[model samples]
Target: MAGRKITKKVVKFLKLYYFFLFNIFKLNYVLNKQYKIIFLLLIPNKHNTPPTQAFKKLLNVQIVLNIYIKEHLGGVIHELFYSRNS
Candidate 1:
């Protein structure tokens, strides 16, 4: 139980910390393409890899997609990723 509590805290901090990091990397790596292309190209790859690695690779894209999807899919954005959840 104590370990679970500590893990939750760490995950939360990592989420806030890494979100901006992913955006920065996205701007660095994901620039100048239409969101359609990005969405099509990257999401499959994101799905294939393990979560920890995919988190690093796909975090920014996920954030961007959430902007579009949250309009239609409702709470999926909240449920789709691992973040600091208590």
Candidate 2:
């Protein structure tokens, strides 16, 4: 139906827009760690309840762990985390 076609077009447009936004945010984060906008790419929505909120908190924890491991334990961390096997 026509509605289905319109919905597909809208979804495609949103996907492309988000891709562009992701690149901009990525460049900004790479240029300055203090920006922290990269986290926005990870956390898609804002919610204060269980499940979603807990997932967001866990993501933040993982981010901290990744940074700590990369900076403080750079040499000891596994190759899987550091570099591509190829």
Candidate 3:
């Protein structure tokens, strides 16, 4: 029973991973080159959620941090743009 549950989870994760990959291919024109970096960073092991939700959470945090930086740093914020691909 426990083994069956584990198998189901593995199957579900593979489905999700493939689904994201398919969407990534379909949206290639719309995706930035840095996207694969984000995707790779969220690859799961023993203690993480799937990449899809993890990437969304990362974006949310990034947005909040950008807002905070702009508010706190004022004009210097314009020079703070950093490229992840760099």
TM-score (C-alpha) between model 2 and the true structure: 0.29
> Clashing residue pairs, candidate 1?
12-84
Q: How much lDDT does each candidate structure score?
A: 0.56, 0.55, 0.54
Worst 10 residues of 1 by lDDT: 73-82
Q: Which one wins on lDDT?
A: 1
lDDT of 1 by residue, 1-85 (tens): 9998878767865775566566655654444245546655765555566766645555667566656543543343344443435
After superposition, the stretches of candidate 1 with alpha carbons farther than 4 Å from their true spots are 22-86
Which candidate achieves the best TM-score against the true structure? 3
- TM per candidate comes to 0.25, 0.29, 0.31
Better of 1 and 2 by TM-score: 2
- Candidate 2 per-residue C-alpha lDDT over 1-86 given as tens digits, one digit per residue, 9 for 90 to 100: 98986686567556655665666556545634543455545655656556667556656765775575446433533343335423
Over all chains combined, what TM-score does candidate 3 have?
A: 0.31
After superposing candidate 3, which stretches have Cα over 4 Å from the reference? 1-48, 75-86
lDDT of 1 at 69: 43
